[model samples]
Target: MPPVTERTSSLELPCQDGCVNVSIVVPIFNEEGNVGEFVECVFAALTPTSRAFELIVVDDGSRDASGEMLLRLAAERPWLRPVRLVRNYGQSSALQAGFDRVRGRYVVTLDGDMQNDPFDIPAMLDRLDSDAGIDVISGWREHRQDKALSRRLPSYIANALISRVTGVQLNDYGCALKAYRREVIDRIRLYGELHRFIPSLARDVGARIAEMPVRHHARTHGVSKYGIDRTFRVVLDLMLIVFFMRYRQRPLHAFGGLGLWLAALGVAILSWLGLLKLLGEHIAGRPLLTVGVLLLVVGVQLVVAGLVGELLSRIYHEGRGGAQYHVRDTRN
Candidate 1:
């Protein structure tokens, strides 16, 4: 090993052969008022760990004073690191940028709006130490402090549907507080609002997921970024996730099942006509013929649609140019 050289002028330095234990990744979007308070509480929460940590605040193209606040904090505090994006891509993209730049044994993600309690982070870190099999420890806000109808109601419905469809059995899938091991960063990818479905993605790759109740504080400095129209997107994404999770490797299964249903209807209609012929009845200008023809046509179309779906899935996922990861910012 080389001699440890300490820079007298600088208190903090980049990763020098694994000196840090945890990295906190916060995605900021127009929350300029709360950045200083958030970082202060985060550092106080992690101070008891006896391990060096870095607080990385990713600015997702805020037109407000968020970027300026981050720069100020980075200058005053040695442990504070700020990365800025060119424009506001979204929360998920900002988080992806944070995860890609993590240099710690474990990483924790939290929203910068100060809704998620930083005090609960230590409890999550303790859980990670106990269970070696656990890949991710998600924070479940059993007693959500948000507005009951507008925010809580939709989140409840979406969480129920997500549990039923994905079979992940997580209480609060949309909670912004969660801790992940370093290995999970390579396997799962996030786009759009898909960050809420991280538990499902981990389960797809055979990772054990568990949840514990955490404190939820109502929004203080900024407005709620999500709106009511997100309900439709959640439903649509649920169905797409079900299909991709179940039949990602085999395209024929998804399409073949639909084809069989259509073919069955066509056969049933034809059987009714055959019975009529056997009983010596006229089969001219019958409605059954039209029904059978339509079913057959639809059946063929569905099969063809399935085949097309498979070809596209393979081509896009396998192509080198096609990608899912997005960039918000990075540090040298």
Candidate 2:
């Protein structure tokens, strides 16, 4: 294996023709046995396609020989770009690293495991090209081949819940075989386990999304990285997505609204207690009064916190030159 030096520093290295038609980004973690076969299969699948493309394989701090294999393969395959992360920062960060380096008109993503078929790329690209209005094409594994009890069942529940909450209905949110137009992908900023929610995030940015059936194969190498625990993580990410979709720009609306409602209820209760006391009704040590006080204090704190969040939001945008809208074009 070649020396595993830091390759991320060369992210800005120039491409031959300034751009490629497609950039395929796959994040791998401890998949040494599958890397070579995966590359061969991808090449076999893509060789017939006339479109110029490059494959970016991200080694997410693999404890095995995956990184070394990637480096070796990259040396032989010029179209293959190897990204070796300093450490395991999770899948989302690895994908972001690849996305930051891609110079292509379309971006394709798939798991490094042999489960997702690379031949499906052409159809996804075809669907994207056919409809100029569609910004994303998500793959739906209509006939999944996985352990029904553990993987498939959890994925089914997650997909349904995500679809209902995000309103971006798709048969398989767990399928990593998806394609996005470069412009649409550029607008997305991934964090946490948000990679699975790309369709939803793209939709939030006004992207027109479509889904198509794709092929799926059982894993041949490496252990599955996901487990039942991912369900809880996905739920948390879903909550974040809901807030981001609705109140990313004006966070106060969410926090302040709830705060005001709680505060009102608290005030009403306290006012009734005060009236009772003024009438000599002896309201001391009442549980309702204690509840009212607690609510009032918490409500005030939430409102203040919301105000602070609003200020921080402004600072974040201004400091980074961020905007609520994206400008595709400007004429002099």
Candidate 3:
């Protein structure tokens, strides 16, 4: 609906002076059965650490009682902040909303299904804080508690494929129990299903990421929002990630390079056809002539597409007042 600028501008950043040590973001969609226990578990887990924390539960327009429960819980717990979306905008959008409102030095994200153990958060935070080099600590569900075929099999395949494609190898890209330094998380803008690729996205912006084994519990309530169909979506999103990783800056290099190859092949084919025509064997009726002509047309179109890509690339970078380079630090 509203543009991101408009949506974010209206919200206030609730934490200043790093008053909040950790901001835990949980995106809920029809998770009424798990909401109360999830909140309590988070509080109980974080309370023992003696670290000030805020729990932001994003209700993604649940048809069930999830929204009402969050509202009731927020009233009782000052630290619990509930964000109600107008309608379900998927997990990525919901996470982005919570990220925009976070007011902590460190940010953590977990599922509202209670499958992610809140108790593991402290260790993740410790790993992040202990290492200056590590910007993100991703959870790896070592012995996952899910069906072999429906969940684990697809997840295993997807994780392997994503790691190989993105070149930021991690055992479990599907685990939502991740911790990030606020700065690292702030640089990322989540959309579509990009939440699953946060580690790879963080790497794109020069973030150092690490993975730690975390406990995964079987779903206690509500059906899994994901299924075998999600594997197809992941593959599509992975293609986007690869394009962004490799061609985000010099898109012309990718498009133009391929375009040039296609154009060259087309030209070669046409030249051969032209030579055959000169040899005079009635080349007008030849199928090769039509194929050559089609290739030439398609090739020209691709090169034109490349030029358009270059223009759009420039606009994207310049419009945002962003550069192709990211500065880690400056001593001057």
User: Top model by lDDT, which number?
Assistant: 3
The regions of model 1 sitting more than 4 angstroms off are: 1-14, 76-78, 267-287, 309-332
Error at 220, model 2, angstroms: 1.6
Off by over 4 Å in 2: 1-17, 327-332
lDDT of 1 by residue, 66-154 (tens): 99989987886777889899999888788888888788788899888888888788889888888887879989988888875778778
Error of 1 at 206 (Å): 1.2
Better of 1 and 2 by lDDT: 2
Q: What local lDDT does model 1 show for residue 97?
A: 85
Ranking by lDDT: 3, 2, 1
- Lowest summed lDDT over 10 consecutive residues: which window, candidate 2? 1-10
Model 3 C-alpha lDDT per residue in residues 43-149, reported as the tens digit of each score:
76877677888999999999999999999877757788999999999999999999999998999999989888999999999888789989999999998889657
Scored against the true structure, residue 184 in model 3 reaches a CA lDDT of 84
Error of 2 at 310 (Å): 1.1
What is the lDDT for 287 in model 2? 97
